[model samples]
Target: MQNDASTHPEGPAASDTPATPDAPVAAFPTTRAKGCPFDPPAELTRLREERPLTRLRYPDGHVGWLATGHAAVRAILGDVRFSSRYELAHVPFDTGFTGELPPAPTGDMTGIDAPEHTRYRRLLAGKFTVRRMRLLTERVEQITTEHLDAMERRGPVVDLMEAYARPIPALMICELLGVPYADQDMFQRHVATSMTLSSSEEERAAAMVAIDEYMRKLVMGKRTTPTDDLLGDLTTSDLTDDELTGIGGFLLGAGLDTTANMIAFGTFALLSNPDQLAALRAEPGLVDQAVEELMRYATIAQTGLRAALEDVEVEGRLIRKGESVALSMEAANRDPARFPDPDRLDLRRKATGHLGFGHGIHQCLGQQLARVEMRVAFPALLTRFPTLRLAAAPEDVPLREGMNIYGVHELPVTWGEAGGA
Candidate 1:
């Protein structure tokens, strides 16, 4: 999550430094070119091209591996020899070396590999199927329209992040998880704290405590009186309340921040590329491909981390036991071999294999829901306001450079009038 400007300059001149065994390579970079915020950092791209699997120096000064190429990234993620266990992972952050990492908390599926992970996945996968998510489309459309209506009434300009991007997913996820949407501010604040790199350890601990306490109470309510929601539906299962609390907390945090950023970042990408925007607005049928391309183009969940359980040969390179590999989905999505003219945002391109939702067993569980939100929200926003455009200059818009998720903190957008370009 470090974007050392001095170490990583903006532009084509970024990755001049070589990645020798002794030299530490940045796991994921926020130092992307200032001129075009959509592209991955030039240094990262150069490394991907030069050495897809190469040596990386961790903040703890231990050496690991960095996976940049699409093939190598997928291999690392899919291979069972590599472990996703939290204790096995080498911390990838820039500061405060925590030499010994803690084990994944109970029900933190992403942190633990199967068959424990299998249990959670099996329990929840049925609920997140395409048909189930699509069933909520009407509600999603209503949410999108309501927000757009608010924006229309508010006038020529508004902060789309707070107004539209954040609320829709917050509401839907709360409904699905049975968390009270009225308490969104508490969880949203927790997400904000965790995503911001500048947040102190104390702040993060407090945020975790707040969200954990809230989830525990919410789970108790589900146990006492089962409602009609994802959490409520799971009350009959044999899983303990502790496990349920962990799962709910994990799902709530995972579902909220991701789709919210996808909306904000996807919109930013569209507004930045007017040609694509024009294409989308002109052809309503292109929504599916547009959403896929945007997911590939602005891979907000930038990096995937895992450590080797044993020596494994991946993409002709050996990753030894206990070594961490930082999978740069941002760089991998933009790999020319996987995506022709990778830098260009071509909506028509078949971005099927892109690492947008990630790959292998741990791919995004809520991708269907995220897709529903984007597919519903984007076109409707464009069609509703033909004149929708960035209210501020491109360079002036705030980017979440320091955080793990890539997006704008606030997107100030404006239109000529309701239904006018």
Candidate 2:
């Protein structure tokens, strides 16, 4: 199950520096040469076996270690040795890191250490509870059905990303935030452009500014005339106006792009794997397990960024404080130790601890909602379009390359007559 150096070639040197006392010692290859190697797990596996704690030369030429093994990645992600809080330090990865970092919504909820992150996350937890998410099931179904209906009316060849993937979650998020449906288009546009690798600095900056302005307005409206939505509930809480606006921006940005990408990517995985798709078609009850498998196979968030909080030894290497690290969940999900034949997609795969939603306290907050959306959307999609097939050749499909999130730019699909059941 493990790949040897003979099977997989050694990637480019991690950096010029030799192993230091309190830094990542081994040199690993940079994704700059290959443009985010997470797409092909073979490359990640090579790194895992050969250079588990090697340095990665980012596009900007900054050196950061890329952790490639299952145990190491999970240990580091859960361990306090590595810190997710990076607001104060001169982020090494930030330089030339083209991905736009939206202005901290909720002020510093994303990059702060415990106590602060704990408090903010606590306030937000009740909002995304399973009970709250269950209450949203009927609405989610309605939203999914509405989008599917629109797609059918549009015709045979439909861009699933535009017609289905984006709208379902976009509309759901809009309903949750209590924003008017008319404004969903504007919010969707800004968030989409901001996440693209092709977007210019000016374009990304504009998107953030536009989103911030919209969130500020929405926060004010909620304060004056509250509705029974997430925003209104937040206003009543002790969080400040700035914090409220921050939450709005965070919800819009995170909820829109991530879930949309998941929908598109998850659909691509299902369509490409005929056996798994067929099994789901035969036994519809396995949809939940199928969704979990999809999340593991299509780890949309390829790698997560964290900084070393203090000196710590992992797998016999000493990592110093302030050093940047990239945890490759894509590799972790495929680790043979965790799952048998990690590459193959299995509908019945017992995928309990997959890091697709992440691990530890900083794990994704909207995971419950995301799971519900996927659980409802996919089975319904297949059952509706029994003969659904990929519109483009698997090799020719245009995947969003070089971005942190792995997704298809567009998913073109065709279905037979009598589209929905």
Candidate 1's displacement at residue 298, Å, is 0.7
Model 1, 163-235: lDDT tens per residue? Answer: 9999999999998888888888878889778656677767766876787788999889888888998899888
Look at candidate 1 and tell me the lDDT of residue 397: 91
What lDDT does the true structure give each of the candidates?
A: 0.82, 0.72
For candidate 1, the per-residue lDDT at 171 reads: 90
Candidate 2, residue 144: Cα displacement in angstroms equals 1.6
lDDT of 1 at 262: 91
In Å, residue 212's CA in model 2 sits off its true spot by 0.8
Q: After superposition, how far is residue 288 of candidate 1 from its true place, in Å?
A: 0.3
**Per-residue lDDT of candidate 2, residues 1-421 (tens digit):** 0000010012332333534533442333324223322244556678776756666654444455678777778888788666665431222233244442432335545565687788889899988999989889999999899888887787778889988998888888888888887888888788767666566677877987898899898899889998998889889999888878877887777787788889888888887778988999898899889878888877887666676666578877765565567778887787777878887989999888888888887788899999899989988888887888877677666777655567878888887754532
